[model samples]
Structure formats: C-alpha cells, structure tokens
Target: MSEAVDPGVAATSEPKEEKPCVQCLVPEIMTAWNSARGACEFVPDEKGREECRKELEEIAKDVKSIKKGSEVIYKAIKSSSNPAAFIQAQIEFAKTHNAANTEAILKWADEMEKAGKEIPEDIAKIVKFYRIQAGSQI
Candidate 1:
C-alpha cells in the first residue's frame, strides 16, 4: 500500500554544474568577498580578527583564481590601444589581486592569442574550473 504520489523534488534540488562563465562570476564573487570584509570590521579581539583574516584570505585566493579565469577571457576583450599598456595594466591588476606571477605568465598567453592561435590545452584548462569560497559566513 505504498503511496504513489512522490514528486521528483529530490533530483531537482541537486546543484547544477560548477563551472560558470569565466567572466560573468568574478564580480559576483568579489561582492561576496566584500560582504565578508565588511563583517570582518566587527570581529573583536586579536584571535577572532586573525581567524576572520584567515577566512578572508581564503576568499581572496578564490578571488585571485576568478581573476585568472577572467584574464583568460579579458585578453580578447582588452580595450587599450597599445598592447604594451594593456599587458601592463593586466599585470598591475594581477599584482593588486595577489597574483604577482600572473602577468608574466599571461604575457605568453596574450602572444598566443594575438597570433590567432587557440588557447593551449593546459592554459585552456584553467578556464574550466571555479570554486568560489563561502564568504560572509562568519
């Protein structure tokens, strides 16, 4: 005498795929990081502050990863007139985002893209992943 009225909500409730658009989700993640930063302001005592900072750093790392994913997209969409300036800005932005080595590595990628070549498999692989931190949960 089993009731045959069960719905498929269990299957529908499962999460979707993880790899979102490389460009679209960066700012969204940044906004979440910002909210965490805001909460960090109220963390009292040195130990609590340190713990909050650690979580913030994890969120920052994810932000850095998002920026890397972004560069994989942005090189095509760069707006500056000079490639030199464009690359320079990208490098600076990467540094600001805590990725000091990213610019030098990306320069090679930029050259590859400039030559109308497809992104190398290894580099393209970078664009295939994203795991954003759960910011502001503290």
Candidate 2:
C-alpha cells in the first residue's frame, strides 16, 4: 500500500509572473533616453539636442499606445463627458495589431478599474460601437 502524502509538504506550483505593462516600460525607456541625453557632450549642440528630442518624441508616441490602452480601460469603468477618441484610436490599433477582442478590451477595462480609474461614458460608447461593428459577419 502507498503511504499518503503530507499536505504541508506537497510541492506547490509557482505562480505565473505577470506581464509588465507597456506603460510601465515607457518610463524606463524614457529614463534611459534622458540619461543618454544628459551624458552626451554632443547633445549640447542645438542640432544634436533636436535630433535626440525627435527620437524621444517617437518613443513617446509609442508610449502613447499605452495611454490609449489606459483610456479604453477608463471607458469601461464609467461614462465620460467627452468621447474617448484616443481610446477609440486604441481599439482601432488593436484591430490593426490583431489584438482586438472582447476579452482583451474587457481586460483593459479591468486594468483601469484596478488602477482606480473609471472609463468615461462617451469613450465607452465609441468603443462599444466599434466592437459591435467589428462583430458583424458582413
């Protein structure tokens, strides 16, 4: 006969690590870029600074994708005064990026709620519209 396993000594599986938020990565990238800005002697020149600034702006735009995601999340939480054009932009992005889905959108909304932010009504309407349109089997 096999002996019973001890409950306290049973091996437990490790929890899956959470993915880093895109927004979270942006600040880190920004910090590194800014540090590069400070350390470069050539950056003292206007042209050099401008070039770095342009690159930084591009990175910021990428970071704005995270902002868009956050906006969608906000839309999910509560109604808003203004349409979340930015968030709508994100839904479009999700479609473009092949990331569109109710689960993903709802997850984004959940994230916003967890962060203590509410989705504005206007933005939610926009997101809802796009989602419905996307589902049509035309």
Best by lDDT: 2
Structure candidate 1, residue pairs in collision: none
In candidate 2, position 46 carries an lDDT of: 60
Q: How many backbone clashes does candidate 2 have?
A: 7
Which ranges in model 2 have alpha carbons more than 4 Å from their true place?
1-18, 22-27, 39-44, 64-138
| TM-score for all models, in order of appearance | 0.31, 0.26
| lDDT per residue (tens digit) for residues 10-102 in model 2 | 555687777677767666555544443332223334654455445444544555444433332342222212224323433444444444465
Q: What would you estimate as the lDDT of candidate 1?
A: 0.48
> Model 1, poorest ten-residue lDDT window?
129-138
Cα lDDT tens digits, model 1, 1-138, are 854556855534578767767567767666555544444444444555455546556546545465443343243223223334334433544445544344445556567678998876876554232111212121
lDDT, candidate 2, at 110: 60
Compare the candidates by TM-score and give the number of the best one. Answer: 1
